[model samples]
Target chain A: MERPPHFICIQLPANPEYVLIVRLAVSGLANRLDFPYEEIEDIKLAVSEACNSIIAGSPPGSLILVECDSDGKTFEILVKTQSVDENDGALVPGSEQDMGLHIIRALMDDMEYLAKPGSGAVIRIRKNMSA
Target chain B: MDIKVDKRKVEEGLGIVDILGEIDVYTSSWVKEAIAEFIKEGNYNIIINLEGVRYIDSTGLGVLIGALKRVKEHEGSISLICTNPQIKKIFNITGLSKIFAIYKSEEEALAAHKEG
Candidate 1:
């Protein structure tokens, strides 16, 4: 049997103003995990981009769910969108919004996007501890 | 996460806008507006001093790029004074280091602007 991963989740209004707070929180958490200063900055930027992506795609008054977990060797985060309109899926490749996803991909070790029409989209990113 | 823009005239028709704070999705528009307003005021030659910026995301980068494009449209030039290693890293990551004329100090950027 696998042990449960240590996780922390935060829910905030889908407003761009709250992205700075999320960046600071993730910075602190990454520091405690012994990530170097540069790596912490990487995490901060990646997480901020992920949150902003949700804010741009979803409608106003939506909520963003951020879940971060660590399993000793790697860190995983999921920025799940809530109540996103199905028709606003214009974050196609090469567009301006897609640049955020590309930045996240460059900063993190691995990433995957799960889009759920009429509901929400989930962006999952993983970073190895030793990388 | 408050952003403060300090605008000062550096030379004839030149201004230096020093942005102090994290530039993200929330605050980037403010930076963009400040630059746009400067362009509107006929200060075509501008240099953005980013020595005090602690963080910047893709939106922030986009704002700078947009400002550059606008200045170019007016036959003006824009240089960047960015000393922070992290900010430089982001610029390099986005291939903006090659696109913009980046210098280590404000004086250097001003000299470069004067040369051209």
Candidate 2:
């Protein structure tokens, strides 16, 4: 039998003022997993960038949903936007000069962009604990 | 987030802006406005002290880049004082370490500016 991953979810208004709260929650979760300080910083930065991008591209009054899961070996976060159009600019991939996307690619072990029908965009980022 | 501009350097066409707190999307505009004010006042030689800053996002980085461009228009420069390794790593990863003058201490940055 395998142990199931523990999941944590947070839903907040799509506002920049709440970004710090998200970072604090994610940092606390990562700290509980015994992640190193430097790795924790990287995870926080990646998550912040994802949230900022979503807030920038989404319409006003949107909601952001953050999902985190870990099994002690790896941590993953899904930053999703709600009340956004399917064709919103937030869902579109950024160009080479997009520093936020670039930082996410450099810091995270893996990343994916999901554009679900009527659910806005999802930026999924993962980090391996031992890596 | 808060910014303090050094008044003593104003006469020398230099602006020393010390920033404290996280420089993310919400607070980056403050930095942009501070630098823009410096440029508008003809103080193009700017020194941004990030010693009090523990975190900075891409929007903050973009503001710094924009300030650099604005200063360059007048043949001025922007020097940064950053002691945090994580923040330094972000500059390295973005390849901004090559284009910007980053010093570990304010003394070192001021000395280099004087030498230049």
Candidate 3:
């Protein structure tokens, strides 16, 4: 049997206030990886943008899952929201009302989107650590 | 996102409006209102001291940029005194540094306002 990788996961209510705590945590993690201050700030903005996206998409009483893992050279961030109306199409960023994902895509190195059951979506990013 | 605005009587025909708080999307309206109120009251010479403000989102930047445009057209100018490096970077990155005269200290901003 293969062992799962070590990671930090947080399940929390969909709220804007939680972004600040996430910023602080990402800062610490990025600093531990010797990321430059500029990179750290980018990480903070990336996370905030992701959380804001989830808060905007999720319905009431839904959960936001945030996961982070370090593979000795790069950091991966995965944010999943278990709230979506599959009947509706994917949300568009900068379409008169959505700017969150636009900002996230600008800050992160790599981004992946997965549409899931129950109107859910998972976004994953690989944040490159400074060499 | 609380706001505290203080008006200081500077030299002849000039006043300073010092604003403190988080000027995010929600509180940015308050900032715009405060500036508009001052402009309407003919207290256009303004210097926003953001040393106490630790955070500012894009909406806040928009408010500042909007006010600068409106006030400049009326022969009035604005500057921001931001000591926080993080907030200063946001201002610079968002190009408010070039649009508005930025000073490191309130006194510097006030002196520049008087000289200009």
Candidate 4:
């Protein structure tokens, strides 16, 4: 049987200038979890990309929320932004502006983007312990 | 959170930028601006020394790509001196290793420039 995951959450203004704080916090948390240095770097890059995506897709002054959950063998992260409906379809490729999402997809083990319609879009990413 | 770009003329048409600090969304714009300023001054061949950069995100990668494009537009080149294994892995994962010239040290990159 699997154990319940421990979760940590953070909220910040949807400002591009503050994304570094999120990266720093997650780096420390992942290090505590004993993630390899390389994996920790990937985690930081993935989360930073998610925050950048949210800030680009959302309206100004909206609050950004980031949540991290960890079980013994896996780690999960969710980023919620008050922004456009990502449910329409995958964004156009090679647009330059949306490259952040593609980079996140490449770095994280698994990724999903859900749009909450009027509320915002949520980007969820997961990484296994073995990674 | 803070990024500093120190520029020095290596030769008549070459310049070096020493980047000190993390490069993320908060600081990538500053990097872009510094590179743009270098290009505006007709420093076409640019070498970015990333030895002091502790962290870089996708936004930071994009900024570098933008700088490369700007240099290429002027028929110039951008070489990277990055020794950190983590940063090198990111470049490999993103396939940026194929896009830019990467060297293990600034001296090696400078030598390669002379050879080319």
List each model's interface RMSD.
0.8, 0.6, 3.6, 1.5
Ranking by TM-score: 1, 2, 4, 3
Worst 10 residues of 1 chain B by lDDT: B5-14
For candidate 1, lDDT tens digit of each residue in A1-131?
Answer: 55454677788998998998889888888988889999999999999988987776565678998888898899988886755332446523223347788888888999877665445566778989984
lDDT of 2 by residue, A9-104 (tens): 889998998988899999988888889899999999999998987776556788998889996677989888865443466465434347898999
Off by over 4 Å in 3: A1-6, A57-63, A84-108, A111-125, B1-14, B17-41, B69-75, B83-85
* Per-residue accuracy of model 1 over B1-116 as CA lDDT, tens digit each: 48998888876678999999889899998988988998888878888999989988999999988988888888888889998898898888888899988999987987888778
Give the true-contact fraction for every prediction, in order.
0.70, 0.83, 0.00, 0.74
Return the candidate ranking by DockQ, descending: 2, 1, 4, 3
The candidate maximizing DockQ is 2
Reference-based lDDT, residue A91, model 1: 29
Provide chain B TM-scores across all predictions.
0.95, 0.91, 0.89, 0.97
Model 1: iRMSD? Answer: 0.8
Q: Which wins on DockQ, candidate 1 or candidate 4?
A: 1
Would you estimate the TM-scores of all the predictions? 0.90, 0.89, 0.69, 0.88
* Candidate 2 runs further than 4 Å off: A1-5, A83-97, A116-119, B1-11
| Per-residue lDDT over B54-81 for candidate 4, one digit per residue giving the tens place of the 0 to 100 score | 9888778998999899889989999999
Per-model lDDT: 0.83, 0.83, 0.69, 0.84
Number of colliding residue pairs in model 3: 1
What is the Cα-based lDDT of residue A110 in candidate 4? 89
lDDT score for residue B94 of model 1: 82
Q: How many residue pairs clash in each candidate?
A: 0, 0, 1, 0
Over the stretch A7-91, how does candidate 3's per-residue lDDT look in tens digits? 6677778766666666668678778777888778777766766666665556667888888888877888877784543234663
